[model samples]
Target: MASGEERYQEFAPPPALRPFVRTIWTYAAPDPSRTIQRIAPDGCPELVFDLGAPYAEQGEDGVFRLQPPALFAGQMTRPLVMHPTGPTELVAVRFEPDGARDFLGFPLSAATDRRLDMVERLAGFAPPPGDPAGQVAAFVAWLEDQRRRTVWWIDPVVRAEITAAETEAPAPTPASARAASAQRALQRRFADRVGVSPRLLRSIFRFRRVFDHAAHPGEDVEGWLEAGLQAGYFDQPQMARDFRRFLGCTATDWARDQHALARAIASQARVAS
Candidate 1:
């Protein structure tokens, strides 16, 4: 792929901001000539600051539109394929399921499947060129300034259930009369603050778990099926259905294709500069 290679790294958030931020990261796609990467929903929202060449997004209508250098790319219900105009570099913040509502100071509904410019939204926080670390640090300062003004719209129980569900916990069902009441309350709070039902979030993460568990490099067909079942699938057939619904491919094909789920977002490519 020449210098069109992708290079990426992840960082932990500062302790004070750990409650809202998931992982901070920087990705560089040097000399990204004509290649574009496919980005799918991993059940999380992000704020991206592109510091290199801009990329073009392919719409459902088959048109390619240039993406803003700094923008809030909201939660996606489906896949997005972006075409790189040239070399690309970006620093990003991955937020927890219910984190962006307070961190970004807007309802999740307004940002879903949309791109809102960061400079216009944040007010005077423009990032200088080639400074990935500084970009994230500045956002941290903004968050710190607004820390006291944050509203606790999401209940702690709701946040806990969301975190559990995202980490591959089984979905809540009718356990008992009292337990069901608590479950319903959490579900309602989740939908209000997170903008989706808890069940849907659980399903998304569950699908992702199958892919992560099944991804064994250079494995044979039987190895693939065993991995999928081990990842909590009922059987091979159930896993195939999930792959089709979430990934538009069979589990067998997914294993053979060598497309890691991380490609849907970023990668740790070592480019030959």
Candidate 2:
């Protein structure tokens, strides 16, 4: 982690076609009195560095709680709990699922996908706390180098299929025709690249979107449901199941909890007790 005295390093994603997959630098002040935690029910993976603090990672408990200045480069297949000791600072590369696959050189299903979990494999790598800045600088330099290289590494046939699907703009027919065409193209692309059809992905995406929207008082549920439907769920039941999978709760319950948590964050600057 770079010290407050050293400099706060922030990296923004380049502007272009794949804007959503941008990797940015994140920083925080060192505070001995505070802990930072994150949880992911949807199985989103991340790359992080643990500067050099004592930390504990819970196994078989479905939760990972860490005490920092430790550096880690890993993926979270389940929920995680993190704590920072003495106001730590660190650089993280956050990636979406597809972008993560591109960056990691392995599919998400690969057991050895996490770099930190196989520390021995990362032999000759930088040590923790003392060299995070150099590590991040090296990563940024590498990403810049890769940016000048090729695009879309899938097989030629798969790339053709992807290009065709993305080109299938909504037809000029009736509303249903446009919707059906768009849905079909998205489904094909998702199956080819993401290993899941757009129908399933949209259900998950919609459920997550609804939860995020309803994470406040006086939110409109009916409107949220309509939005979910537009995002391609067969109906509300499918969407609800998605909520259960990623959030470990029904839609309504998850919304309430998020709202309460947000209120607490805004009120006293506290983490979950």
- Scored by lDDT, the top model is 1
Using alpha carbons, what is the TM-score of model 1? 0.79
Q: Evaluate residue 16 in candidate 1 and report its C-alpha lDDT on the 0 to 100 scale.
A: 77
What's the residue-level lDDT of 80 in candidate 2?
43
lDDT of 2 by residue, 1-273 (tens): 334432244455554413324354444444332333334332234555545343454445556555333233433333343444444445555544344445445544442223345334334545334344565665565455554563534344333332333333232232355577776764454443444443333333444444445445455768767867765567888777665665556656644544211222222211110
lDDT of 1 by residue, 163-234 (tens): 677656644443254476787776566655575667667766767665654344466768767766756677
Task: Give RMSD to native, each candidate.
Answer: 4.6, 8.3
List ranges where model 1 is wrong by over 4 Å. 1-5, 152-154, 170-185, 213-217, 250-273
Give the range where candidate 2 is weakest over 10 consecutive residues by summed lDDT. 264-273
> Which regions of candidate 2 are displaced past 4 Å?
1-11, 15-21, 25-38, 41-45, 52-58, 62-88, 111-138, 144-200, 214-218, 234-236, 251-273
C-alpha lDDT of all candidate models, in order: 0.65, 0.44
- How far residue 34's Cα lies from its native spot in candidate 1, in Å, is 3.0
